[model samples]
Target: MPLRLGAFVHRRIIAPGALASATLLLAIPASAASYSPGAPGIGDPYYPAYGNGGYDVSHYDLRLKYQPATDELEGTATLLARTTQDLSRFNLDFVLDVGEVRVNGAEAAFRASGEHELEITPRTPLPKGTAVTVVVRYRAVPSTKQAYGFTGWHRTPDGGIGANEPEAAWWWFPSNDHPLDKATYDVSVAVPDGTQAISNGTLQSTVSRLGWTRYNWRSNKPQATYLATLAVGKFDITTGRTDSGVPVINAYSKDLGDNYGAARASVERTGEIADWLSGYFGKYPYNALGGYVPNTTTGYALETQTRPFYSPRQFANGSNVSVVVHELAHQWYGDLVSVAGWKDIWINEGFARYAQWLWSEHEGEGTAQELADHVYASHPADDAFWTVKPGDPGPDNQFHLAVYDRGALALQALRNEVGDDAFFALLKGWPRKYAYGNASVAAFRAYAEEVSGRPLAAFFDTWLFQPSKPGVSAARGASISTRDPGTKGAPGRPESWKKIAATNGVHEHPER
Candidate 1:
């Protein structure tokens, strides 16, 4: 599922404040640099090409029809994008699967890329703030891994949805793809009678007339486009809450009766983690959270929005709730305050991976130090990790263990050095800072330095840009020598809800 090639770029992302020319630079090792902290890639600008970089997407409406036997979906997407410039050219990111494009009621010329990309040039210049109704007609077959890693519509044999990533939904619709470019969504899906369609928020109602049915789901909160998800098929899902009171859901196939037992422990544990995380990060970022098991083909799960897509066959401990906590934490970091682009994926993978470790710590799976030790052990000892940004991070860097795990460990170390108060405070501050827009590796480095009140350039250079893992003892020795015993033991902890307030210094939508 690797791309034939990556996009060319003027600047590569190295972490916040870590931008570099596209030229190769070998200084440190991040293990899986090909896919980790500082990958090199160009910006995937908002669709409609933001007419002279003037607009950002604020809302969207989706219409779709599904053909189960062939596993295909046909649909039209309408979007409302906000811009400050009067634009003549409009371009959107779409796969080769989509065809036919009309802009503001006029046919537009376009070209295709991959199975999921289309470049359209509009006929007339659209004035900024003049919301254009971009109507796109398209058809798509499910994928193993294509276009933003979305494998749409996993289902149980009974025809119930097991997992869906609205991020993956881009193949089905066109809008601002980043969580930072969040907008309201209204989805209308046509499915057969035996199936139920589930999306981001509450189910409003389903209309079934004329031998056709359309299920409409609406989300009022500011939603990162990727959070949009739809699961269709058959599976029995039980819902409840934990002692701490976060809602819990477990979905399993009909024949997997014994598998149901795992849900008991998983759900409760999820609830506990939910309460604890929300307590620190702020209220649960969304209205609800759920886990859908679509017969585990993959060993891992995604921390999508309220609905986390999972595969049951990957349940190793017979208790798969750790996946639950990992995804739930994403509601705050990834969903609410989204990363700006693919290069900043560590904002997603690193944090989510660390959340898993954090959960293990909370559950007594290990001490925080032990978790860090485990991650450090997993990092590769080669220079490839650092020399390569995402594009150069290495061929296997896309979510590779070395980059995601080891990279996250770097932040964990920073957290420990900064103390829990500063550490969690930074976590809560990040998303809020870049709410609804793109961020760069440079931005993250700056944020960390600001929050830690310490310069991290050298530190980032060592771990984030180096071509290989720094010797553990060397890293530890530096930490010891540079450690400031005078730094407050633990700064005052910020109340979780404190970050609920948006600040003005940084632009949430950088592309805007």
Candidate 2:
């Protein structure tokens, strides 16, 4: 199983003031634009060739056929995108053996160059902002790869689950395989008659023909390629809807035996947690709420887009429900507001981990402050948690203890520094502001500073950048010292939902 990667970005809001009435802009000349190949990568320092440049994909309609007996897959990925540059050629990240490539319905010249770059040459040069459809046909056995400390995909007993985090989308299909390029999805998978198939989003319709059953899933909300999942197995599925009416679907295999009972109980609790998170973190960010193929093989649970993947080990505490809370919280923090680069993964893992702590506090296990303090005190100066700070942990060191546990500590530290009013304002504001977009650590630092109206450079540096544990005196307070003690206690006191809902200067989605 793949470990959870992270989410969210903080954008600095600058009031226009007197300049609001002015309208001034610059225009580009036609001659300045020329046809050239789009870059092979999006310039991410960690994985430079991860996602292609030059186009913004709006939607992907994937028609796929899979045979469980033979472990073979045939797929046609139709990508609808608008070119951001004049291009005679462009690249897409694809690792499979391709049968054909078509640009705008015509067979185009293409080749699989290097390990993951698929160079495609169109019949004509595509102009800037030109809407074009790129269709790729391929047939191969679905495979998983391990890179960047994350497993690209986890093969299950029946079929497989897509766990591509940093760079694994190409292993299963052709894609602009990075979080920076998010697109809506329409996935239709054809499987044997009895075996069920699951993917992201709402199940639109199911058609049975001959010996195959086609499951059509539609994701209207924009989603990063890594967050996309495909689950095929013989399982028991239950369906319902959250109180707010978001559809809920849960699937689990029968191999778990008695563990299946606990899995069912956890699935039943998903709606209640979703409702709570929607209220705490803004409206649920996607069209559906679900978990797919909860088996024991996948060691880790992933916050896959509309549906999260779970392992029996994750629910070991039976109805503990922390893992469910963590993944559901990600729909807002990770799925809605994604990380701009892999390095800023703390934004995703940190937010989800903090939500887990919030769940614990809500359940009376302990307040977030107590949990944060416990973890912070347990780590010695020479511990691995302090060796790689969450902000700049190298590519191979992601999903370490620091990324999840210490990352939560950083958030609690910030909450303590800026009181509950500003902290909770940021919780709702950050996701709403960067909804359906990519964000970076720099953006987060600036956003936190702006929202709290405090200089937090040193705070972030000490908690997220430094490689040594900070001083901790349990009697004085939590690990990080608060410069301003302005009439607010630590983050755990019960507050009226009405007061949290009354937050001012907080940016919210217009629809909300």
The whole-model lDDT of each prediction reads 0.56, 0.75
Q: Candidate 2, residues 1-512: lDDT per residue as tens digits?
A: 00111112234545577354332211443223456788888777877778877888889999999877766778999999988767778899877779999999998999988767899999877887789999999987765432333445556667765664565577667898888889999999999999888888999999999999999999899899988888777888899988999889989886776677777777678889999987678888777989865454545677889798777655454543666777788898888988888899888888887887787677766677766666665566677768888998877666666787788888898888888899998998899989999788889899999999998888888889988876554224434533222334533323322221121101111111
Model 1's number of clashes is: 62
Clashes of 2: 2
The model with the greatest lDDT is: 2
lDDT of 1 by residue, 1-512 (tens): 00112212244457644445323355543222321111111234322221113346667788888766666777888877654344445445455266777877898876764444456556665544567667778776654335444444453454433233324454456654444456778888888775656666655789997766788977767776556776665557677765555555555555555555674456445666777886567666555656666553444466556666655543533766656666777777667766554556667656765676666666655544555554344334553444444212432354544455556667776776677888888877777776545566778889988988988887777666666665656457334222222344312222311111111101111111
Instruction: Estimate the Cα RMSD of every predicted model relative to the unseen true structure.
Output: 13.8, 11.1
Q: Give the lDDT of residue 184 in candidate 2.
A: 90
